[model samples]
Target: MTDIYRKLYTSSMMPSINLPKHYNYIGAFLSLSCNLSCSYCINHLVGLDQRRKHLSGAEWVEGLNRIQTEGPLPISLQGGEPSIHKGFIEILNGLRKDLNVDLLTNLQFDPHKFMDLVDPERFKRDLPYPSIRVSYHPETMDLAETVNKVKILHDNGYSIGLFTVAHPDALEYIPAAEQACEENGILFKTKEFLGEHNGKLHGTYHYEGSVFSKEVKTVNCKTSELLISPEGHIYRCHHDLYNKITPVGHILDPKFQIDDIFRECTYFGKCNPCDVKRKNNRFQNFGHCSVEIQDIE
Candidate 1:
């Protein structure tokens, strides 16, 4: 095991809740509920036993406004389906301008409403990829319909793309979707499936035995990023936040802040592969994990 202990840099480095200083990024789960329930959905992987909490439009604006994002990085608004959030548009326009805004949706809503409500500049970016990423689920969604929506949004000057998961069952459909997207002049891409499939684990992960296993152990974990649950609670790892296994603080509280510190966790075996996996950084460069966990003692 690799144990990396260095100077705590970000506001998330404190052990206890305090004011967030250098927030690399902020994610607000507007709502965990989705319109289409894909079988391969990671949100449903651990079973939805965890309590679901949602913030109203006003509450979301208040919580999101408090975040201090660094650089051009924006607060990624995602959920089981971000569009499902009741206050989706209000929350988008409500965020402070200093804090850039991004959205990850399923394109399950009315595009006319979206275009009328959100300003294209609000999601503008100099980055290579679109600021708004829409997931296209083959089993639950029609490619033609999805593409049409993308076209409408694209024509309206919205920066967007269609992202699909490469599940084993749906692998064959991705090429077809890509072809359709190409014909329509749209940006389409596939993401590796990251869960159990036909008794085999998939996706690239940095840590061994972190997924599809029953064994558990203790370890010291540190995170360079900020993770917020749908209810506004902050977490140390994707596992603790997504599974509701544990949390450090809630953003709803005015006094809550990102406390960056190495905390002992016993659910090492249950950790989400996304957290431990060595993957691409924000620059799309290889070698990055949502969390940096080590010191397995």
Candidate 2:
């Protein structure tokens, strides 16, 4: 395995809970408020009844800087639309250099403004994937407009790419999108659609009944990813984060540490697809699971 992959599978280097030193991934949801309301949005799958809140840029910087890791480990800034955060630019400029930063966005923000405020090198890293991932939603996004924005960023030396979920309904449009990206010298990829569409589950999951099920069951579950909400609350999994369940810790807390152990969960059947899905690891190797669940009864 490469050094980067090794770090991902290694134990935590610092003394703070059992969080592996080379953590596989760190996801920071700057804000869950998105401009587009696609019909298949996973965030609204179970219905987010509460108003989402977000932390200021300074708070996010302070909290995220505390994280210690080595090598290719990156803190991914994502959200319903991360750029919608009030301090999006500040946060981008504020993260420590040692902490590699990646972004998942919709390419709806102003590229000129981003280029003016942020240094492109800050997002550059020696990794297999582009540092910035732009999602293309054919339903609500204009393909020409989105491609123009990506070209703007790409021309400015930012490491970026375009990804569209392979929704069954949207499959036909993907090839044309890919060809367009290729013509523009931009990387375009497709992600497997997760969750139910027309009463059928769409993705491969490790657990049998962890997604789209009406019944709930108890099970012991533990996560490998560090999922931080916009307000800095940490969750055991994506299911807990979007559903607003109690968090395991607050990133701002000086004493906060990751508890790398399994806890009992009463919503096994109602789990989010992101958490239970059997997918590729950072190395693109198949059969890797984000969380491990057992003890179901």
Clashing pairs in model 1, backbone N/Cα/C closer than 3 A: 12-259, 12-260, 13-260, 14-259, 14-260, 206-277
Q: Which digits, one per residue and each the tens of the lDDT, describe model 2 over residues 209-253?
A: 788788899889878889999878899999999888979987766
Say which candidate scores most in lDDT: 2
Model 1 regions lying over 4 Å from their true place:
1-24, 48-51
Where in model 2 is the C-alpha error above 4 Å?
A: 1-18
Residue 107 Cα positional deviation in candidate 2, in Å, after optimal superposition: 1.1
Q: Quick one: best TM-score, which candidate?
A: 2
- Estimate the TM-score for candidate 2: 0.91
TM-score of each: 0.89, 0.91
lDDT score for residue 97 of model 2: 84
Clash counts per candidate, in order, are 6, 4
